[model samples]
Target: MYVLIVGAGQVGKMIASNLEDSHDVAVVDRDSETAEDLTYEYDVLSVEGDGTELETLREAGLEKADLVVASTDSDETNIVVCGTAKTASDAFTIARVRRRTLLNTWEGTQGAFGVDFMVCTDLLVAQTIFRISGFPRAQDVETFAGGLVRMAEFEIGPQSPLVGERVEDVDEYDSMTFAGVFRGDEMIVARGDTVFCADDRIVVIGSPTSVKEFAMANVPETTSSAEDVVVVGGSEIGYQAAREFEAHGFEPRLIERDHDRARELAEALPKTFVMESDATDTEFLDREHIDEADIVIAALESDEKNLLVSLLARRVGVDRTVAIIENTEYTDLFETVGVDVAINPREETAEEIVRFTRTNQTEKIAMLEHDRAEVIEVELGPDSALTGRRIADSAADLPDCVVIGAISRRGDLVTPRGTTVLEAGDHVVLFVDAAVLDEVSTVL
Candidate 1:
């Protein structure tokens, strides 16, 4: 597959990096250095020009490409790029925009913007935060098979009871699989001989009940219903999050400093309590009894401000805190310094664009171990390599790192065992370590 990506910024570069090895990737950017950097470092072609222009797309071989992804920082520019590409090629069109208003503009209009799918940055981040909020102890949570199954990542606490136990000795349930463990920078596909240790970040795949049970056994968490949520900042991200919470039937209080903006937001969002008070003011928070809140979200404009408020919230007594992080470098600091989750909009946008460009056959794709591995959901086609084979026989030829998490056939979820035989039209979820993506691709 030939993938032509517009804009070589952080999000564009990440998508190119993921697709470069498996497909033909070409990047377009106005900056010569940034475009040249991708070509020099990765197996991709680079065109140093504006992607919204006609000649620029031609220079990047847009007409011959299988997919065109527009992920520039500007939403208008991205829309124009995708529309332009649609005129010149028959490629699948995906546009990354920061504003939902821009996306709604083209809805029900055929080829109006030439964007087949639109990935809204704020909405994706909000949805991710909302999902993780349900399992406060997990660092990351993604659902597959219609929310009946889930894959969650957790960092084993120092005082966890399972710290010294071997994988083989632990009681196994019919509903769960210990998928992989990240010991420092190394990834280990959990086997019988594997031993649980403190500080080992592990990925688990199971039903929601099983995952919650497993998380409870491995991590220390406060026993809170987390019904009350406090949101800081009147930024666009904050507004979007509040809207998402309301859609999910959760009423969260939003704090804004500016009086006029607060008043406008209060009128606009009747479901949320929009307060006109400084979040930095400890007095206002204490008076509002914010420390007793179930969850706190710091969505300020600046990274420093978000960190400052999150730290303050934690100091006061919020058990779970999520910070909106723009700079990727601040991600590790936020986690180490005690923020429960740091939402990076660029990464969220990049992951989806890469996954879509990689394949059109798979039902869904999710990155794990910081993109070192992928969990793919696909329906077994009639010609699929694994359609007629038994699970054990298919496992023998596949990479050792592969783990079949779940199989859905006839609306029933089956935890795959050795003798399980996959038939055509079966929906299967599997975790494939990055080392064998090509092999996994061919099998499915």
Candidate 2:
């Protein structure tokens, strides 16, 4: 597939980077220097001109492109680029929008603006922070299909009451089901006989209310308490994260280099403590007592700055360190550097765009990356051929591209063995290489 990307900014660059390995990508920006730099670095085709102009888009070979993504910082520019692409090439167009009001009623604007999908970075970031904040004990919360279903991650600490329980006997609230558990580097799709041990990272999936009830019932109360968190950076994303933490009863201390921005954020978020300080300075971190904080989030726009701050926080023995890394190229490096969580705004935005674009085929619940593969969720239709077939029989009929992760039928989530049968109303989750998505879709 060929894709044309507008803006060449962090979000556009990220989309291009993620797609370039398998798709022919072209990037356009008004700034010639930025376009040249990205092209030189990523080997992507660069078109230096205003993306809003029809001529500039034409020069970028939009006619042959399968998709056009407008990811410029300006919302107006994004809308214009999408409109022009739709008119010129009739290609699938996705526009990046930040305003909350626009996203609240995006369905009304979809056809009028000639946009196939609206990627709301603000809402995506806000929703992500909000979900994680709701369950402070969970490492992450990923919801699918408007919160009808959810996947939550919780680490088994020493104090967790579920440390030595069998899977079937484990006590949980009525509506929740344990989907899987990750020990060290292996992921075990838990069966009835599997046992839970200390320090196991478990993934649970169920209805939103049921999952929350289950967590509260099974986990200790102290585990979910948000006492204190230190956030390094005053970027928009940082402010959003801090706001979320504050909303969840966490005391947030924000550190930023710019005094004026710090003061502005302080005024905007009265509950949060805003301090003007360099995040990478270890002495300053020590003086601020960052080691005492329960969580440290490095949301600096620069990947290098976020990484440095995260490393310092980790060295100080902060329990959890999350860094917002704009560059997708450094994702692996950040993991190797010991950052607890690396938040890539661009990749997150791209994932949202892709999800919106492909909403018809599959409901993307969460994206998990392994050694060299990705796992995604797709709901099965009652009419689907794979339904009602046993795992062994379905495995032979399924295209070589997809591997069934688990099947959620009725309210029970089962890790399918050879004899386990899939039902007509089941929701099947799959782990597959992203390259074969098309082939996998046909089988479903």
Candidate 3:
């Protein structure tokens, strides 16, 4: 596929980097330095010019491109670039917009402007934080179809009553199903006899009500309330997180290196305690009693700094440590270094745009990962041939590229075994590698 990306900022660079390995990619930026940097670092063609200009876009071969992504920091620039691309070419266009206030209006107005999709960064980040804060016990929550269904991840603790319980013996709670269990490094397809234990990360899928019931039933009763949250860094994202935490009845403390920014944050959030000091400094963190924090979030702009501070918080016995990482390349490394959660605002925003772009098609993607993998939840079409077939009978016909994790039918979620049957109207969640998306689509 030929793809043209308008912007050389962090978000544009990430999208280019992710797609460059498999697609013909070109990046456009008004700043020559940024364009040169992208060209030097990746295998993408870089064009230095105004992407919204028809002449510049034509020179970049936008007419022949399969996809055009407008990711500049300015929402106006992105909108204009995408509109121009859609007018000049038959390409799929995606535009990135930062303000949440513009999102509802844009969704209704973009079609007239020739925009294929609109991505709102502020809303995406806010939604991610909101979902995570709502379910403090889950390490991650990926919603599908406007929150109609969700996939939540939780780590089993030693005190969890569900530990060591077989799948079959566990009572179904609010129509939820265990999707898959990540035992150490391997992701296992859950079975009836599979037993959950401490340290195992389990993925469960269901409606919001059922998921909450499942968490209430399986998680330890000793789970602490979200009373104290320490946010390290006073960047925009950090400030937003602090505001959100405060809104949710949490006493938040915002730590920053710059004295001016710290004072400003303190003034803006009178309920939150603000400390002026380097977040990476152990002495400062210790003085602030970091160990007493229920959740410690390292929201520094730099990924390395965030990772280091999060690791230190972990070593000092913080209950949960989350790091805000700008660069998606460092995501795996942050996870390896024991960061409980790594949030990438740019990547998250891009994902929302991609999901919005695909809403018109039958490819109902639920969650997208930065690593080129997608988890899709699609209802079995009534005319589909696989309906009413048993899992054992349909094994050979099912696409080898897709893995069915769970099935929901008649308000009951079932962890399908070999004998489990698939009925029409059943919503099946499948984790698919990007390489075989077409094959999976054909099979479905």
Best by TM-score: 1
Prediction 3 TM-score vs. true: 0.74
- For model 2, what is the error of residue 409's alpha carbon versus the real structure, in angstroms, after optimal superposition? 5.7
Q: Give the Å shift of residue 320 in candidate 2.
A: 0.9
C-alpha TM-scores of all predictions: 0.96, 0.70, 0.74
| Model 3 lDDT per residue over 1-444, tens place | 788989888888767766676678888999988888887899999999999999889888897898888999898888889888877798988888866555677677747456777777755665566576556677678875445667778877898877989877884754566666777756555667889888787777767777777776677642434567888888777877887777767778888889888889989997899998887677877787988777787878788888888988988878777888877778778877788778888878665544433323343554434534567777787666567888778768765444566676776666666688888888777766666665665666
lDDT of 1 by residue, 312-335 (tens): 999888888999999988888998
Q: Model 2 over residues 152-266: C-alpha lDDT tens digits?
A: 7776766777877888888344445566677876666666677888868777766677677767766554245346778888887788878777776766899989989998999
How accurate locally, in lDDT, is each candidate?
A: 0.85, 0.73, 0.74
Ranking of all predicted structures according to TM-score, beginning with the best and ending with the worst: 1, 3, 2
Candidate 2 weakest ten by summed lDDT: 365-374
Clashing pairs in 2: none
Q: In candidate 1, which residue ranges exceed 4 Å CA deviation?
A: 222-225
Model 1: colliding residue pairs: none
Error of 2 at 324 (Å): 1.3
